[model samples]
Target: MNDTLHVVEKLTEWRARALEFEREIQKAVLGQARVIRLVTICIFARGHVLIEGDVGVGKTTLLRSASRALGGDFARVEGTVDM
Candidate 1:
């Protein structure tokens, strides 16, 4: 019983942190609330995400914003074809 209560308390704290993180990202990202929430959920779940969108659709910005909000490092990789 004590262990279950501890787990629940930790989950509550994590949920609060995740909500705050999402709000921080929202300040830097405009008109992408759904995407931001999805990203936040992914982060909380400890899952990887692959974001696909048209060029100039703020994909990089989204990740960077989230990273900044979480006080973590962000890196981007570009693909190129070499002949």
Candidate 2:
């Protein structure tokens, strides 16, 4: 019983932190609520995310903003294939 209570408490705390993180990211990346929400979900789930979009679609901006908000490291790589 005690262990279950502890787990529940930790989950609640983690949820609060995730919400706070979403708000922080929203400040920088406007007009992308869905993207922000998805990123936040990924953070809480401890999952990786792959963002693909055309150039100038705020992809890098979104990732960078999320990293800053979550206080985590951000690394990006750009690649192109030649025919």
Candidate 3:
């Protein structure tokens, strides 16, 4: 059916895009390959992730780097005691 063909085409395009993104991330992140790969797998597997660590441990760096690699939008939120 035409609808099926359209769906297939869209999926193919999306997969290709995700692959390209993975390559870009690999290039940007020189070290920390394991962490990066884990994050990537989590994303693809549709699993939720919680990264907790002391400050200045590259948490934001990892997210920003991944965002750039994925060619996608990135948003950062800070936790507050009141909220």
User: What do the candidate models score in CA lDDT, each in turn?
Assistant: 0.91, 0.88, 0.77
Q: Which ranges of candidate 1 are over 4 A from the true structure?
A: 1-4, 80-83
Instruction: Order the candidates by TM-score, highest first.
Output: 1, 2, 3
- Clash pairs (backbone) in predicted model 3: none
Say which prediction, candidate 1 or candidate 3, comes out ahead on lDDT: 1
The model with the greater TM-score, 2 or 3, is: 2
Candidate 2 TM-score versus the reference: 0.80
- Candidate 2 Cα outliers beyond 4 Å, as residue runs: none
Worst 10 residues of 1 by lDDT: 74-83
- Tell me the tens digit of each residue's lDDT in model 2 across 1-83: 99999999999998899888888988888899898889889877989998888889899999999988877889988666852
lDDT of 3 by residue, 1-83 (tens): 99999999998997886677666776755676777767877887788777787887677878887877766888999886888
Could you tell me every candidate's TM-score relative to the true structure? 0.81, 0.80, 0.60
lDDT at residue 63 of model 2 (Cα atoms) = 93
Number of backbone-clashing residue pairs for each candidate, in the order shown? 0, 0, 0
